[model samples]
Target: MPSLPLRAALVLMLVWPFLAQAQPALKVALFEVAPYAQKEGGALHGLYIDLVRGLGAGAGFKTEIALMPFARVPLALERSEADLTISFSTEALEGAAQALGPVALVDSVLITSLARSTRELPQLKGALVGRARGGCQDLAQRAELALRWTDISNFDSALRMLALGRLDGLCLTRDVLHHYSALASIERSRLGAEILVGQRPALLYVRRGLAPEVIAKLRVALARRSPVKAD
Candidate 1:
């Protein structure tokens, strides 16, 4: 039993939601990996993408994600070619890059096909290791492996090389083995990976020279949630 003015006010209140605008443009970069960054049917989808989308929505911004090979990700950041990059190990945050928040803590491990011979760290001498370019997981220990490094651009290729026994080991986050193998129809039971090193904290890195306010907003958005997905 509201009066005419009250009825009109209530109608306006309900309509205000429809009149609201969409989020503003916020450019984001994503590498080809899953449950983190994966592209299918001309659209980006994954856990990290979801987490960023949540942040963008919560912070009032629209996301413009660019999918690229993992190796090319840091190069894009080094050249200030991207506004933001999906999470990566802090060790790779070189050049003018600055980390925003810890997005995930994943077990970065070395994987090999079960058929291939497994070796301990000391036994890795003279062994061939495959890893993504621009990655710095165990670059410091490369000399210990006699430094036979083969930079790969795609996960399936690296796994394929391992299955073919062409590479002694391929190091990456363990989730890559679980998700990418399912996508590529490679059986996971046929492979094994060990934590060649300790867990790594993955964080989003923004190239220097970006607006401080934008970086601050992103940091606050992520810090509030911690976005800590243990993968």
Candidate 2:
């Protein structure tokens, strides 16, 4: 028979391990955007969301997503407030965060007002171009041909600004723009014109200095997930 003191000690030992095993779960930051990262019915859902869930499951970790404004993603990652981010481009990850697999997600498009404008033709050279802040650096770098840029908070704002002739053009993910255009009931005729100036491959971004094992595990999981097809 065990003494009362021995039974108490045994109980403590068993409980201590469970408490020790309850480590903090990783936090992934997601922005409210369509087909990529968005909150639907109080839950995160999208292509990137699905991919991240799969990666988390394969890596044997719990991932909790926090939805933040699009402009704040870089700041959150830099401050270590978020463990991971999705749909960022290579150039975007350079100074912001360490990136994982290419993901090779969506392509961006250059959109110009269809109306005759004072700006140059076929491109935004020497014109004011509007883009979502912290969205995709690759598109911004390519659109630097005009040498002028305007940063907006959201896609709807960019579209409205362009429609109101406040900006010479807008650069955004092609699919995202189309989705918002439809949701906003934007008249197709209202848009001046658009051009597919270039394409960019998206990637998953993690805070710099994450555990190497964690990164390797994430990469392996993403590779097994395969490339996402265009919707």
Candidate 3:
């Protein structure tokens, strides 16, 4: 018969694999970008929220989502305070985060103040334009505008600042503006004209140094949730 300690050691060796296979619970930081992510009736809902939950389920992971300010998401990822975040763009992607998969959820628009009395699209050169700190993607090449950019934490703040004449215009997704128009107390008619500035893909970002298997599972889950469209 095996000694008592030998038997105990064998039992632990068998049990440890099972424990390791158990799904890990992760904290996912979500931002209130509207239509993409937001809180409603004390629960989170939106395209990105649904996609994230579906991905987590497929990957055998349990997730708890907390709404966070947009600008703080990068810091959270860098600090390992949040395991996952969503809706990040190419321009915003940093070395501290690992991007999993892409989702086509945003098309940007540029909105200017009606109070400025400029009917035509104002030349952005030398203008004080407001943009959400981590929300804008693919806009860095517009260096010719010499834009006085103000980076706010969220869409609502940018809208409010523009309405109050603190900004000449705001650059963001039209869907986001429509989602928070009522909450921002800005009339839709007063938003003046909007310029379509092209669309870009958004992706889920996780803290760097995650296991490759975990990243693979996340990519498979996202692919199942939002299949890549043919060009």
For model 3, residues 1-231, the per-residue Cα lDDT tens digits are 999999999999999988867757777887767777788788888777876787788988888887777777777777888888876564444766887767555667778876653534436667777787755555545776676778777677778777777788888876777877777888977665677777666678888867788888887777776643312
Report the C-alpha lDDT of model 2 over 1-231, residue by residue, as the tens digit: 899999999999999978756955668887778868887787778877887777787876778888787767777888889888876664445677987766655666667776534334434567677776655465556544644777777777678777877777887878888988887778767777676645666677888877788888788777786667556
- Estimate candidate 3's alpha-carbon lDDT, on a 0 to 1 scale: 0.73
The full ranking of all candidates by TM-score, starting with the best, is 2, 3, 1
For candidate 2, the TM-score is 0.81
The stretch of ten residues in a row with the least summed lDDT in candidate 3 is: 115-124
Each candidate's clash count: 0, 5, 0
Tens digits of per-residue lDDT for model 1 on 1-231?
Answer: 999999999999998876665434777777867778887888878878887788877666777788787766777777777777766663555564788777777777777556545646656666677877756455445565584678887887778778777788777777876776777787766565454555777777887787888888887788778646565
The top-ranked prediction according to TM-score is 2
The whole-model lDDT of each prediction reads 0.72, 0.73, 0.73
Question: On TM-score, who's better, 2 or 3?
Answer: 2
- Quote model 3's TM-score: 0.80
CA shift of 163, model 2, Å: 2.1
For model 1, how big is the CA root-mean-square deviation?
Answer: 5.5
